[model samples]
Target: MTTALWLLLYGGALAWLAPPVLRRMTSQGISPQLGVAAWLATVAATLLAWLAALLMVIGATTDSVLKGNVVTLCLELFGFSEHTPIAGRVGSIALIGVATLTAGLVALRIGRCLSRLRARSHDHARAARIIGKPTAHPDVVVVEADRPAAYCVVGRPNAIIVTSAAIESLDQTQLKAVLAHENAHIAGRHHHILMVLRALAATLPRIPLFATARHSVADLLEMCADDTAARRVGTRPLLAGLSALAGHPAVPDGLAAAGTAVVARAERLVTPTRWYVQWAHRICLTSVITGMLTTPALIQVLCHH
Candidate 1:
């Protein structure tokens, strides 16, 4: 009975958690910082769920080994003589089996996603090569696209591709700023992190938390890039670069372009407000903390059986 209950709890948690993470990853046009934060949250939540499941498995195994003894011990400890019903025992076992299967499936899905992503990365690198000269740095690449497009193509040989158009679009200072931002994405390996979170969400689509995390991380990643660019080149030139690129038709989806969030980024740059950005930052932090705090409670609930 305890085993079954443990399984149900863990299985339910996994079922609940998976969807949100997946949704977050697939959602459109999320900023970098928000995306990162959301992904981090999803990871934290998934880890906690995994840990809880592990503990439940341990508990179930122990209970199976000492079924009769455990029931007797429980009776003695609680001064009760009621034996668990046969149906309850069977149900518990079923729950345990289901939970184990769910976890296994999730793990398998994540592995498959990683493998696919690796292949995709190779393909992206090949495509990037078609465009122009490859840079020595693992993250940044100078491409020869006709239009000014500053974007990061994330994969195994994750490359930050910037076009000659981009070079000509902005002054030398703005170009430096643009490169700095792209470099930050590469240096931070932001794409890999986003991919993992997205995979987690795909594996478990029922978890709203994962969705929230994905969107938040996407937005945050952009913000982080913006921050990096702002630091390298003053906010004014960065703003100019962003404005110049905002309406460019060449910018593609899934690539971090110079004009990705031009208006919002510009607004933030011009009227810099710690209150606004920090508010978003706090939302990400709060979500993480809430997940962390709830984990112990979740574990305790599992242990009660």
Candidate 2:
């Protein structure tokens, strides 16, 4: 197959097909970190494949400008029968402009998002301190609020907030679970993880790849924390805490917890990943990651076709 068709297979079709499979793997009760890695691998592969295709398109256009015959060659290669000289030349030039414009816009958007997230993180850390007070837990702070609220603000002196309602509502074991859960957030460095992915997503909000990546990573991070907390304090403690905090407010941007996945986390803890499912996740992800790492080299070699 020509490079264009190969690009479509890897970049266009495979990108859309892979996300669901990754999501399914996450639900298999396998290793959450591995699931997160697979999600990252999938998105990186899709982005790299699309980027390779874009470079190829631009290179072809450049070739047409200097080499003269590249336009006619590509038109015939792709079976474009409306292959007038004027049409071929115009198409290549137009593609060059479009690719340039797209790259510029994506760069600008990513820069703006990173700037905003930095500012927000600063403000969020400040506000969390004002609302909460120092507790025995060096990392955690408790605030007096009637409504239930629990969230963490990232960076040094990270805030893991617990509301009056949360403290009053939960038993000693459940409260320990909450602390363990928030502590897991700090240890896992989920805030930094999500922030980086969010920056990438901001660059290409129109693409499903970014959205799927952000969600999948965030969810897996939460699961990883849950696993840690469970092993430390037992699953029942985290499970009860999550149940009581079901209707609580959402965490600040860049923070993750058992907030959204209360039911899912509970269910997962009840069941275990079968050996077959674990092996399947490993096998499939290894295959995709290998393909992702190698495909660009192969595509580059065949690009002249």
Q: How many clashes show up per model?
A: 41, 0
For all candidates in order, the CA lDDT equals 0.61, 0.73
lDDT (10s digit) by residue, model 1, range 222-289 = 67877888887778777777776677753332446454456666665676656666567557556654
Top lDDT prediction, candidate number: 2
Worst 10 residues of 1 by lDDT: 68-77
- Report the Cα lDDT for residue 173, model 1: 78
Model 2 TM-score, all chains together: 0.81
Per-residue lDDT of model 2, residues 1-305, tens digit only: 24644675677655667767667767544778777777777777776777766776788777887776545333444466454443266777887899889977877887888878877886777777777787887767788988665667774567787888888888989888778877888887777778868998877676776778787888788888888888899988878888887876576563535476677778888886788977887787777678766876787576554
TM-score of each: 0.71, 0.81
Q: Please list the residue runs of candidate 1 whose C-alpha ends up more than 4 Å from where it truly belongs after superposition.
A: 1-39, 65-93, 134-140, 154-157, 248-255, 274-291, 294-305
**What would you estimate as the lDDT of candidate 1?**
0.61
- What's the C-alpha lDDT at position 33 in model 2? 78
Whole-model alpha-carbon lDDT for candidate 2: 0.73
